[model samples]
Target chain A: MNKQPEKYQVFEKENEILRHSKDVLASPELLSAQAWQQEYERLAQSYAQLLGEVKLLTSVSDRLQNKLNKANENIARKNEELTQTLEMLTRERIGKRATTIVLILAAFFFIVSELVIDPQLQQSAKIFGASGLIVLKVTVAIALKPIEMILENLLLKTAVRKKMS
Target chain B: MENFFLEETSKTPKLSFDVSTGKFLMSGRSIPENSIEFYKPLFEWLDEYVKKPCPKTTFDIKLEYFNTSSSKCLVEIFRRLEKIKDAEIVINWFYEEDDEDMQESGEDFRELIDIPIVMHMIAN
Candidate 1:
């Protein structure tokens, strides 16, 4: 009996078939007519079974591949969603910090204007009216929004750069 | 006979075969680098078990995914189990509700193996 390569054999039955085929090929005249017919029938049966097994394996393997592909897609989508959410949260946090910083600066300017600038203006012969002082405070208040926006954008860019690095 | 057990890993499934209860389970994913090497002991254990199998044997298989080589090993496992003519063997094939591929794979195994295979849907 010729020893077939183990790597090429999927099952013992397949190995047996290969051995039988080798033996028949080596001595074709030794097999009687009935034995030859029996061998043919057995080969046919094994072929049918092998064909069925191959079909089933192919179908199952294809399905598994599809499943894995879908799972990979799902993971990618979820990762994208998580990254977006984190970015939104980071933006919100930076925006709040910027707003708080602007508010504190605004308060300091108000106090300095009340204590120092107001007395200077009161003594200066009223070159500018009280409404001018009101307009100055209003302008500072109006600048607060843009200042906060600039600070938020700067912080966000820094954060993105740090992450990339 | 002693029970055969293997812990589940990232790339392989969990395998547990109890001799006392005749309950076998293979769960999780099976995409090992070498499936035959991984499943060799289980096949040997089954070969010994069939000789003195319990009156009623039940095998529960709940695999989310398996590679082509692993599928061939699975077929070999089922064929070995089909040899237990003296015992009442049943295979419970579990699949996730949304996993039509797994369900159909189980159905395909049912068509090939003689042992009674019952399809079960795991609720999402």
Candidate 2:
């Protein structure tokens, strides 16, 4: 019975204190102060959330900048390589054209010597001794043979180089 | 002696040979698909010209590029020029200032062929 009464008394004391505080806050000024405190707490929470969002956005911006820089560097490197390749190709093309011109001239000379010069020499040789004519023809052939061989070797080398490249 | 003038094509060089004027110029690029076919008529003309040699035969070569096979043809041309005993042959080799390969090519031909050759370097 004593324990039950003590519990009842403590509950009554708490109720009284709550009623007194409510009566004190009945004034408009006091009520406004309470409302301001609640608003300040809400604002603080919102500020914290906004700060977190700003931090996330800053990190994302830094990552994007790094990616863009890497992409630019890669593009620059590729452009340099492409330029070098184009230069090399131009040189090779020029070399090939030069080689072709030389070969055409050689062929022309060979045709002339074989068709016209050889026949004239042969006809003259017939008037002279066969021995002299044969020697002359052989000498001319020998002289021309080296030139022909050199041209053939050069052509072969060019073809091989092109294939290798 | 007849005049042989072959117009320049995409694959061949320009050839202007005049028997009267004795101004034979072979210039531009030469990279023909069939070298023998392209040069046959030119060789025939040269053979005919050799019989009645010109007083002054000036061969101007300003080729930008040629192949190894073409080099042989050049040698043959040089030999023909060398054979003219009664005529004066003046071979002018023109190259670009920055082209070392062309300069060396001129030197090689000069060494191999016995002719009065003049080498001139021009700005490309």
Candidate 3:
């Protein structure tokens, strides 16, 4: 039954005014053109931000494409170099294989001729004279030794050169 | 002068120089193990030919590829041709249209040599 406080009354009146102001602000008739202008400005700023993002994405895409092209060119050049190198290596390997086969055949013939044919020839030459037989053997040994040494030296030189290269 | 003819190997080009026809052709790949041995006699022959230079000398170069050594030999051949006096030298450099490297190589040779070089781009 006591009288309400003055502070409470004043607070109630302030709340009522705030509520009325909010309603007025919400009303279309109370809204000024400046408010719409501000809203439009905000929307324009957001659009500008989105446009900037799109521009950045485009630039990034262009850079990526350029990098991809460079990578492709590098890969192609590497492939070409590899192919040429492989071809050269194969040619050299085949040449070496052929040379090895020839050398093996030559050695096989040399051994057969020296061990079997030369001894038989020397025995047949004994029918002529011991001097002739000894001379034939000496001649064959001298020729074969020099030839063998020469071949060995050539092979050694070739091997050394190959290793150095 | 005797004609120069060398059979082509897997890694070397065919070289045929006809003295009567004045036609010289070098075709195929060139990556010889001994470039000096392969090219020494060729240069000597060209040197001798320059003494009795023909009225028209046509060189047909249709190389698919070459290494650095072979490139040096090619330069030597071009220089030999450049030394000829009172002789018309015609060099036909043939390459595939899509071979950018060969095109650039032709351009490089053209810049290095002072001779009439015709670059022909053929489709492979």
Candidate 4:
């Protein structure tokens, strides 16, 4: 009386057939030729049925696995697309912040040049003149581009670090 | 016979076998931890149903997913239905349009079972 495996425990009909086969095997010479032929045919039919079941089950299982694999691939692709969109949004936000910071800095510099630097340049009108004031304002205007670039890079780095943490 | 209805859960499918209508439905996921235990009542109901089956026995199987054990239980269910000598039995197997795997599974069961299993696609 061989114990059925845990997975095959539910297959009571198949197990019964197996037990009958074992009984037949135990007394091989007792049965006549005609009886033996009948047993052989019965066993053959059972085997065919079991084979059909096995084939169907295997095919279904494989198909389900494939479906799960495809679903996983889709999720992975969607996750990647989401991450790219998020990064783009972060860059756009940082770009706007950088531009605003640069604008404010430019306003502060303009105010200082008018209130503080213009008076200081007045005393040195002999050597510097009004061209000195023009040069100062032009330098400040040219520096805004690099200032904005620096601020954007700094903000981007901070954002990246925050995300990593 | 009383109608047998089991609500669908995370691990098991909904089973609705109306004695009056003879329109049985087994839908949703079927990945129960104990497949045999989960399907025992259905099998018993089917056995009784076969003794005095309805004129038109329509079984609608709209499962999205089922494990191997559930599939075996399904085979048992089909075998029980085969015992009905008089009833006009039809199994309507439904699957999503993009779910070729599920469609192929329906075809596989159609080949194995003696009863007519009509495959229907649910538009994605």
RMSD (CA, angstroms), candidate 3:
30.2
TM-scores of chain A across candidates: 0.85, 0.48, 0.46, 0.82
Which 10 successive residues of model 4 chain B have the least lDDT summed?
B97-106
Per-residue lDDT over A9-94 for candidate 4, one digit per residue giving the tens place of the 0 to 100 score: 55978889989999998999999999999999999999998999999999988877887898899999999999999999999999
Prediction 3 global C-alpha lDDT: 0.72
- Model 2 chain B, poorest ten-residue lDDT window? B67-76
Candidate 2 lDDT, A45-105, residue by residue in tens? 5556345434533443444455468769999999999988976775566566655666676
Error of 2 at A109 (Å): 84
- Better by TM-score, candidate 4 or 2: 4
lDDT of each residue in B1-124, candidate 1, tens digit only: 8999999999999999999999999999999877777888888899999999999999999998899878888988988898898679999999999888899999999998889999999999
Candidate 3 per-residue lDDT over residues B4-106, each given as its tens digit? 9999889999999988788999999887876656888898899999889778999999987776556656766886898998988899999898766666677
Q: How high is the CA lDDT of each candidate model?
A: 0.88, 0.70, 0.72, 0.91
lDDT of the structure predicted as candidate 4: 0.91
Compose the digit string of candidate 3's lDDT tens values, residues A1-165: 234453233223234544655565578575689976775575566556345434533443444455568779999999999988976775566556556655676678679978888678777876887787678656755665456555555665675578679
TM-score of each: 0.84, 0.44, 0.44, 0.88
Which candidate do you rate higher for DockQ, 1 or 3? Answer: 1
- Model 2: lDDT equals 0.70
Q: What interface-residue Cα RMSD does candidate 1 give after superposition?
A: 2.0
